[model samples]
Target: MRARDLLTPFPTVTPGTSVIDAARLLADHDLPGLIVVDDEGLPASILPGTQVLRLAVPRYCQDDPALARVVDEAHADALLSSLAGRAVRDVLPGRPRELPVTDPDATALEMAALMARTHSPLVAVVDERRLLGAVTLKVLLDGLLAQ
Candidate 1:
């Protein structure tokens, strides 16, 4: 099976978009995150919800005390209060690693191996360097269950 066979199609976001806007999209669509795409329509990274929460918190990284120092030791607590008030880009994890590509001709075992090696729940399906969609655990499992 290929990624297109099981991958769900979700909206894509561009780089430098406000984290607040991304969070709104997640809430409106009831999605986990948005796929950051480049101009040529390639997957760039993911902006997941939990990352947004982290950004909203007020903490001074021991090495980087800039935020803490700016807020002053007294006002730091007030500034670092809530995730709801913050932007997604501030707290999102580093981008997810890209998965290797394989043709639909590849065996199911080959797909499984790639997934395990990359530790990815999904892999992008490509043909001649074009992304068609994704193949995920749910899609693969559904195929097996049907058989």
Candidate 2:
């Protein structure tokens, strides 16, 4: 079966939303990332949790050489402090190359190749003109196991 058979639709987010709000959305949905949408409602980016972690570093420790030296001594506190006030957008990486999407007709091998190339755990399932949902490695594995 195609990935769409197991796909689940989730709420989307806009790019302009602050990282703080995005974090709240993630927490509410218990998601690791969100499929960011553009004004036209097209997939734009994937904002992952690691991006938030990087932004949580204290500016003093991140920027000042003297402070950077002390960070080795007070690393834990500095890191925690950095995360307290930061926004999510401040840390997210530039969009990585995404996987090639396919319609309901795509075969499992096609999905596997796209994942292999992009190292993506999930492939965004799309029709000729619209997005549907994502197909994850877990979905693929589970389907195989069920057979």
For candidate 2, write residues 1-147 as lDDT tens digits.
Answer: 777786777566776766667766867877655667668766676555444544665566567757766556566655546444544445556777663456766777788887677655566677766778777667767886788
For model 1, residues 1-147, the per-residue Cα lDDT tens digits are 544455656576666566667767868976644566667877665544444434655445444766546665655554335544444444545654644455656566777787677665555566676566656656667776787
Cα displacement (Å) at residue 42, model 1: 0.7
Off by over 4 Å in 2: 57-92
Q: Which candidate has the top score in lDDT?
A: 2
Query: Each candidate's lDDT (Cα)?
Result: 0.59, 0.65
- Residue 52 deviation, candidate 1, in Å? 5.0
Write down the worst ten-residue block by lDDT for model 1.
79-88
TM-scores for candidates 1 onward, in order = 0.54, 0.65
Clashes per candidate, residues 3 or more apart or on different chains: 4, 1
For TM-score, the strongest prediction is 2
